[model samples]
Target: MEEYQKLSLIDPQRVANLPTPDKLFLFLSCTGSIEYPGTERAVRIVGEKLGIEFIESVDQTCCTGYMLTCNAVNPQLALASTSRNLSIPQEMGLDVGVFCNGCYGYLRELAHLLHSNPAFKEVGDKANQALGREKFHGHTKIYHVQELWFRQLEKLTSLVKRPLTGLKIAAHYGCHYLANKDVAIDDAQYPTFHEEIYKALGATPVVYKERRACCGYSVGRGFTHREETVLPHITNKMLSAATAGVQLMTTTCPGCNTALDREQKTITARGNAVSIPVIDLSQLIAFALGAPVEQLGFKANTTPVLPVLERFIK
Candidate 1:
């Protein structure tokens, strides 16, 4: 058995088949870029530190998976757009690294459909016919940035200068990453890789009751059902985290970051005292790895992360 395989019997898929690529086509997330630009900046710093080069292309566009998730766009259009965006990385002969769970899950599923389903392959063919030069052959593998971090945990730990020695951090895996259980890197129901990463950084990983619950923002629930369902759902999740004494929270998805970070104000307004600062897992990793705080872009976060930073970041 491989060394990584021996680490976990439950989620061997996480480390057994994990790719440690030196170069990747970094798929930019619309939410991450617009809402938390620090995610990209932090990812770049981590990549540089880890000796991985992140490549970006202007030809790539939004994955269009969000629209499909919201039931707002035609399936054909979403597939075509995904195919087009994927083709850019395939042509460059590089796999994709996505920072958002939504992008990772959506691209992975759509690409699977294109490769496995003849009906979806037909749609991909039509999309290729429409595009003059590029073609998506479903050759590019999509990975969440957190998986990459796990793959390089040893090296990442070695590079940590600002260790989170006394902080209590919780992981929000988000729903999309494991929606397709067959392709997931960790156990869908009870993942511990995030906690493992926390340990690597010397931080105490807090386990809360609602750790596996959905962020309530997926599929447009935050917008369509904020008052009735979303607020209460997130309130419960936050209350559980707060009870667990989670001083900081990390997410693999920017949309979830937006929901967890921004909704705390609303939760406080509704008489819940939950205010755990939420950030991208990549940003936290970069912070621990000694990346400058100014580049991490905490300014855009709705819930101020300064208090959490002061706890560990010197």
Candidate 2:
């Protein structure tokens, strides 16, 4: 690549003189809806509160990462799907923002693969060409809404009507998000941004031993190793949270929320009867921004967020 060409591709500000994406092209994962509906509402409410625009496309499809991880589809198929989905917003000049760690990591990795390997690029290119759409040149960037919220923390702080007073909350940064630690906004081993986010919303952020631990279900690992690995892993993680006096746990990924929340109800059967409600970070922000309780869709949680509602939702 020529010097100017290389600079244009890497520089967000210089490339095409493109204005930084202000309107988030929100990408909701399957888990975001079927498992945790609050993520959708939370993103909308949080976007409204932050004065940031959010746009959704029906043409957008699942990131297909979960299927790839589960061995349902080969990496080639996943790459093709990503190329097509990413090409949609790339043509519209919008950056993609995902509410699931799986999608963010999955797409980012695929995009990286396409850029680094001519072989993968050819596969994606052929797929895009066959579909008769713009070629997927890996032109678009992917982000998590957590990063967006962190960027607009002050504005988020200003909108908090119901301060989460004395609500001891713990942050679960999923394995995929932490995978890119060197490029992360905070230390991956001990990130304080989520805790800072808690203070911004007037809540106490708890620190625990398993704060950075995996949920044991990444990429269908739970299905393969649930009995031997997943259960014991979650049990220990939850025990640490309960020990730290954490009342609620917040997740940026809906998949993480599903594992953490659903697993809480069965901790007792495993010999320790401890439970803490797990919710999406977006829902917490929405509640703080004064979105109606019904809009949060907390009913999707099996662990029951009622205690949280009873405490804060007056």
Candidate 3:
């Protein structure tokens, strides 16, 4: 089989492009909007601190990604729909910055398809032709804001008014970010985006067995596999955090948030004692950036970061 063929059916280009100056079209995933609204708040605050302009688009729809994952939507329709969705950001002439891992994965997948798949490209081209407007040139770069933060590591470190120096955290890099080998993100074997970010913010990153395990968000939660597969998978991740004395666990996926956060209580109810906080990456970033604790959405969390908040205040 060919190398690209070995990647997931969807592939995202890992190429780097120049940064553009315009209002960044922030793409919101369904889970991110309602469940983790604080994450949206964090992204905006961080962007403001960095002087990065951004705009949110309500015209965009759900990446409809969950449907595509469960074999509900065909690739052709998914691809075209995603192309239209991405065009919203392109209108701003700025590269899109995605906070949700699912949106990142889906947008990146389509970007790769437009570049590599003639069929997808043709469909998109036809649609653009019909509108007689600019088509997706596939020039826009897709990024997880975490990547931008990584680029500004030194500046971020300087601006960290409240460093999480002694806070032990487990960084969860959700699967969608690196399932495809071609778009292979940061050594999938031992990805470290979250860990590196934690370290830069002055915290220790804990590596655990469930570091790479699926959160069972889309499937396990929707189905009756919570106890059998979901719990075990989540338990493995949390137990590692607990054993390592990690005070908190962070995730980039809302679905992962759903699994890790909501399930933490269930784990405790089962006689397993855990004191760790499950937080979104944005929450952690916001916390590090010295945003007020209330703004970080700690209140919405199941495994609250109150202790962590107490430390920041002190």
TM-score of each: 0.93, 0.89, 0.86
Model 2 spans > 4 angstroms off: 1-21, 72-74, 219-225
Evaluated with lDDT, which candidate comes out highest? 1
User: Over 4 Å off in model 3, which ranges?
Assistant: 1-23, 125-134, 180-185, 222-226
Judge candidate 1 at residue 44 and give its lDDT: 88
Among all windows of 10 consecutive residues in model 2, the one with the lowest summed lDDT is 1-10
Question: Can you write out model 3's per-residue Cα lDDT over 14-83, one digit (the tens) per residue?
Answer: 3233243335778877887687788888888887777778787777777757656765446766666677
- lDDT by residue (tens digit), candidate 1, 1-314: 10111244246655668887889899999999999999999988898898889999988888886668666556887788888888888889999999998898888888988888888878877887777746677878888888888888899999999889889898899988877688777778777889889889998888888888888786345457546678888999999888888899999899899988988888899898777999999999999988888899999998999888876656
- Estimate every model's Cα lDDT from 0 to 1: 0.84, 0.78, 0.72
Report the error of model 1 at residue 10, Å.
4.7
Better of 1 and 2 by lDDT: 1
- On the 0 to 100 scale, the lDDT of residue 208 in model 3 is 61
* Top candidate by TM-score: 1
Write one digit per residue (lDDT tens) for candidate 2, span 1-314.
00101111122222224223468687768888777877887888888777768788888888878667755546888887888888888878888888888888888888888878999888888988998988887868787878778777777898898999889888898877767654456556656677778888998878887888887666334455455556778889999888888899999887788778887666778788887999889898888878899989988888888787577887
Model 2 lDDT at residue 145: 79
Clashing residue pairs in all predictions, respectively, total 0, 0, 0
